[model samples]
Target: MARPKDDDPDMFRIIVATDIHLGYMEKDPARGNDSLVSFEEILEIASKNNADFVLLGGDLFHENKPSRRTLHGCMALLRKYCMGDKPIQYEFLSDQSVNFDHCQFPTLNYDDPNLNISMPVLSIHGNHDDPTGQGNLCSLDILHTAGLVNYFGKTSNLEKIQLSPLLFQKGTTKVCLYGLGSVRDERLHRMFVHKNVTMLRPKENQEDWFNMFVVHQNRSKHSATNYIPEQFLDDFLDLIIWGHEHECRIDPEWNGIQNFYVSQPGSSVATSLSEGETVKKHIGLLQIKGKDFMMKKIPLETVRPFYMEDIVLGETSLNPDDHNVLKKVEAFCTEKVETLLDKAAMEHTGNRKQPTKALIRLRIDYTGFEPFSIHRFGQKFVDRVANPKDLVLFHRRKAGVKKEESGADNELLAKIRPQSLDSARVEDMVRDYFGQVEETSKLQLLTEKGMGDAVKEYVDKEEREAISELVKYQLQKTQDHLKVRNASEDRIDKEVTHYREERKKRKEEDEEVAEALKRAHSMRSQSEDHPCDDDRMSLDSDEESRTTRGRGRGRGSRSRGAKETTRGRGSRGGRGSRGGRGQMKEPVIATNGNRSILDAFASSSSSASQRSARGGNKRKTYSGMDMSDDDDVVTIDDEDPFDISSSSRKQKSQRKTTSRRGVAFDSDSDDDIIPLPKRRR
Candidate 1:
């Protein structure tokens, strides 16, 4: 899979270009296709030079999602030069260790031997194309899916931390090409943080391969920090091809990093007629050997000639209505247009042919000529240009005229006026101001509260009052500080009294609640020890009859039931508490129809007592015994009929109601009861 090194030829022949910016001229219908045309020329240059492959920096499209027309046009040009005579017959060196399933638009023809792809275009998405949300759904994805190009550097797969490179072999040099698509400045900063980014590292054959890093990012000298520093990149890259910056430059070897060549191939077309872009546009032709490389700047001839004519008027007081003055402006434009056309003709005399149309920008600067009249004059001359339809006009005021209109010169003089502040006067004023500050800092008058009479002898009554006010404020602040310090003992005593009274009331209430619960639990334990199904029913009937008569159980009945439960426990003693309790009879189950009515009265009665004693109706589910692991014993299925809240309430009410009726109310229902809430560990 390697190109022969028998003759020791360059290890790789690469064509690096970027910022094609297709559709840049969408607004300029006449010249809008200029960017696309220049891009076609760049491809031709790559083909003519027999470049091994092409590396596009970014901004291949001017928009994140280009128009259908732009996309089709760009694809047609790429297919012309890139579609090979036969299908591609290459295998990735790291295919076994990588996966492309995460690619949203993976190429079906990536390994299709019947589909030929030559000088495969490898590109990263630029700012214009690198949009949010469409990590793998951008315009480039469309081309990649069609097998027109190879797009790398997207980390869509969660399984991978770093982007795997596209590998190729040419003679003794194994090329490992990696790319990082353009990212916003702030996001990129986070990527550059220590341990934040997972950069591509060399594998087992590091010494045998030469690595090239391709990136689309701003790399201007002034804001170089916005880009990944060259020194930082040199740790892994043998060469760096940068894009996004529309200026062509080359550093044979970045001074800080040895053996690392950095190249910027600028843009193929003039996206703007800016001063920097006005220079000859170029692409880089890189010839790389094992560790040595050479970069040649090849000029692109598809650019439309741009003519910027600056016509400065002399101090002859030219009038806009003057035919002579109009003629003078017209002549300047005609001369400049002709000069550019001739120059374009000469440069395209060889293989490359420049566009015939020219962009003419006229800047008229004069004191007397009105802008409207001068514009009309410029248009007349522009109409006569070789190709008026292709001519673009621009107008501007000259520097001198602009200055006169704005009065900037006068403003400048005012800003730099040395006569505004004399050194002696400034010194005296500064001294006087500081003298007043010093006098105020050490003023004895400020300490005197009633200094109105004494200070009036030397100053005005108003000044004396001002000093007295200052003294009064200081005195008040001091008094407030003392008051806060002296109030600590009184505040502590009040807090202690409030908490002591609250604790005493809480203790009394807790004891009453504990006694009531103890009686309820003892009745249930006594009932469990004596299994009497007939007795349980008798108790229920008596309680129901008593409640129906509108007479709750008499206090004598509660006392008699409590005595009987105690007597039962004493008669059985330890034998009844243990063995007898274990063999207790199961309680009579109440149907939903009957349980709801019984539970209602229980809740009302319990809540009444709690409200009267604690001033709050706080109901609690009380399990007589500790059942921390009770959940492990009771199985609750989806179809379980028992709801813990209602069941616990029904059982508690049944026992209390029966006991109030001067009868034993014992049941086995408490054994299947829900466990209490566990205390914090």
Candidate 2:
């Protein structure tokens, strides 16, 4: 590719890369410094080229909490190559407060007088290094705090995203760089579909500035909503830097529909031995002059070479029943390994500084043949390969499988392989597991998205009570809804009872289904005679009913509730201690003041009450007392009842109170009060 000329005074030269994955395999003796070396090379390139700044897509570090060695190495590299006395040419035009809201300095590193930064490294957090814990801090935040990197695109709110661009100007050219760090793919997809994400455009020169967006999301369709569609972005964007995918496709591709150019500067270091990671790694030099930009791919010479191949012993002239079968199979595998080593050596010919040991993966199909010990076979390449233990894997092709089903299986595996390395989040795993179930079989009270979010919170934040809190919040909301409809006391009790029974039944059924699935999977693995293919074939069969249950429980619960209500109506006269079967009760909803879980629901309910007041709804009597519509209603009483003074009771009696369903009550009267039903226990 031809490089753009550097003669234009208004041109902006920026170095762009992503998924450096620093500290990957940091403990491994052979590959400990691999990520650090490549990262240093990238910084050296930026310094040599005199780039305006270094733009990182995401995942600068492989681990969310990087080790001390990784942090020290990263700081040393940035200080060595990025700090200098060189004058900065480009000028920041955006509001620093909005762009760097998460940072204390709230300005460019160079702009801070305490820090002498020459090369500004601007980045967003990827799934691997996203925020966690109570402080909502990521590894990048530490770097940002140290004034070594400028971290933008840290989304504080997921309900509605308002993307504010970091605008910069060089001479007469202007560039508006919008960024959205990384959000859970499914949640982000839903936001896009609901039109909740808003891009804040430049207010002044709307057409003059070149609009560029940096996003770290799944560019490919992993599932229905696992990836963001290109069409979701606004058409006004000139170019987009896509990240989070590991494949190296640094060249720009035009999206004809959106009329924008997309350049995916994939990961600079290989974090896995998958085929996608085998692509030659490269970073890009992005040059922008006004609305036109060019990408120059610079190959990294320090990345370790990886080679993979698959062989079938059944296809070759090898007999399983022969006395020398094991020897022949070993010989064939040895030849393949030697050939791959030679290929890696040829590829690494010019780069003498690169690691000598290459990553090799040989998948052997041993159908109709006995498999040899992989541990013993790998011992031969312990000295020649970086990953000897996983160099060779054995598998068997199941017989009588349809082509369509086989293709589907392969596609599913393909989607999982790249992410399974390091980018797979807890939410992604939960989403994938639930993806196999039929939509109708999913939980009716709680959404699949909500459950996935809860599980993600529990895993990522180590919050032991997150799942329980979600269950309680959902149940509370359901009960509140029942109260809003002004159901009779007996009806509310019946509905609540039915809900509890259904939830318990579903829980039991799900446990049984999960156990059965586990047993079936185990049996299939034992019968397959190939343990190496377990992970790949785990979700192959029973794809639809994998995590699903029959709807019989819901139907049965409804029928039983109907019968109980009918029987209660017949025995109404026998139970005189209880109120009449159809008697209405004042809605007394309990509120936990200490918990913030229901704060959102409280706010929504308050707004609904305001709307109801605006609609001029009439106030109804609760205990034969007429109250004005302007009376203050407290449906959820959080005050201390025992500590109330006589003066406070007088004040309460003066002000008329109403229920959520518009039933007004007198605080001083108790003649018409009906006692609530006591627990059976």
Candidate 3:
């Protein structure tokens, strides 16, 4: 509702300046004492134009309660130019355009004479000022001092005021102004109490006139789902000065209808606003001509912003050096310290004892640096630098810390506030919290030595289920491969067992063959008379038997000698001519394939060598040597009990040439194939 008796819109010239952010840390010591200097400049601009009243939309201080000296400087400036105390306020005024006699700043927040002078300054709170209904903090305290500001909207409680159906009245035009601002401690102006934050919600009974609604928040033109829907005031707003936006925009379309003007006056001081949130720094002046109101924008020049730099620490340079990265960093820190010190020195020059303009703040950000140097620098800079606005050390230093892991075994101990996972930083933060928590721990367990009730326990909630799932999957996928491996191992065991059995059978056959050959050789070597002395001589029993048999069967004894030569060679080799008298048996050994195949090759090979040796010149002792029985093995092959190729003559002949040996092949009659065996000494 708009009250017609309030103030006329057409008769008065209105200037809206907003978002001053006066105690801004970035602009301090550079912008003519403080950021409030821009406010004084605006007042001078208002006086030349003979404005009626000035409306400051919000955020007058970077801090809720400015520092005492910066606060006094602001009051002193407004008293001089904004009230009756200025040289231009009365000097160029033939028609005392504004009355400026009453003013107050000391204790009370009541109205003063300066409210009537120059253009009265009216203000509403923004987030930075966070106006509490209690005596915690307010812009009213500062505004009351110079008598330049009026109407401390009932901000003591987070409550909204209703207009009386009529606002300021002109000769025919009446302008209704509706004000809404942030309540105390609500984050970003959300969650205001229902009792203090709503106007006449009965939409049909909402007052009609030139309505001006001022609020300190994001423009409600974004999608309706993100922010609180009740905060949107789209009901018949003629001129809406959306105060919280820090960018200068006069978009008529942003209000969702024609003839709806939403004006954002940006900032009264040129300070860096939120770049990430996309709000620019600007101030707004409203110039009304007839039925139409025109707007002009003034940009507050920003002082140099806070410089942020990242220097990487390397393995080679992690240890601090004189001219290396550490030295450059030191020089940078020293320059920043000097810059802040110089700033403080330049303020309120030629003072009685202290400064009138007063200095406020300096901030430096240190990120991505090693902790050892940062700690040393933080201590040294604080001790050495003079007269700073406010010094904040943000980097991680061992700030009254406690060690997390206490032993050489590298065990991790839990701390209160974990660091940023950056080396030493998170540890440092944890250390700080640990010390605090440890103090609390001691107090809580003062009577006992136990850890008491303060320790937070560790539990692995996911381990059992995760292990079960993993094992189940593995069994499902790999069972077939496991079976294949078992089968391969079984085959290898069978092959090894077969080889050992074959080797034993071959060893027994070799012993019988050797024994038979020994008896046969003795029969061929001795005479029949030698057996007459068998009981009295050096002759072996088998040899005596063989010698007696030789006299009985001469051909049989000789054939036995040939068999001896065959067996005595490597495997079944015929003995080579002992004195070059006859063909000899050759040597043979197993390479691979069947054992029978090797025996056949050996038997055949021996036959070939015997033929060659019989053809040679040495044939003298052949008359007496009884190698006949040994020679009969070829006849045995033709009638052998074994059906294998080993005991067959045709197969033995087929194996005439073998890769098993380089023995040359030769053919001989069965008798000529094996040579006569000689007697051993």
Top candidate, metric lDDT: 2
Candidate 3, poorest ten consecutive residues by summed lDDT = 449-458
- Model 1: per-residue Cα lDDT over 273-342, one tens digit each: 4444545678887766675566777877777665555565543345567767656655655666667666
Q: What is the C-alpha lDDT profile of model 2 across 1-681, one tens digit per residue?
A: 234469678899999999999999999999999999999989989988889999999999987778899999999998888788887888998899989988777888899888778889999999878886545688888888888999999987767899999999998889899988888776788889989999999778799999989999988887897799999999999989999989988899989999998998898888877778878899999998877789988999988888889898889988889999999999999999999999888878476568989999888999989988888988999999999888888889988856556877888877773443445667667767777888666465654555666776556545445566566666675678677767787788666656645655554323322233334344444445544332322222112111111212222111333321111211121222222222222322223322232331233223344335435432221211112321222122223436658447534433321111122233323344444443353
Every candidate's lDDT:
0.54, 0.72, 0.41
**Model 3: C-alpha RMSD to truth?**
42.3
Task: Tell me the TM-score of each prediction against the true structure.
Answer: 0.51, 0.67, 0.38
* Clash statistics: count for each candidate: 2, 0, 32
Cα lDDT for residue 284, candidate 2: 93
lDDT of 3 by residue, 1-681 (tens): 122222343444667777777766534343434466566666766666566557777777666667776677667766665555332121111111111112224211122333435445666677667533223336655465445455333333323434222134444444555665543222223333233344432233245344666666654333332233333454566677766555556433344534466776766543432221123345555544224555556544332222222233332233444437557656665565667556545532343422232222223333445333545555555543322223333443334776665564354333222212101222234335545665435321111111111110001111112223323333332344345545465565454344334434443322222233333334434434244332322122112112221112223313444423222222223323221122123212223322232133233333444455434321111211233434323211222337565446434433431212222224333433444344454
Candidate 1: where are CA atoms >4 Å away? Answer: 1-10, 86-91, 96-102, 105-110, 133-136, 156-163, 193-195, 221-232, 250-253, 257-259, 307-334, 350-353, 362-378, 381-681
> What are the RMSD figures for all models against the true structure?
26.1, 20.2, 42.3
Best by TM-score: 2
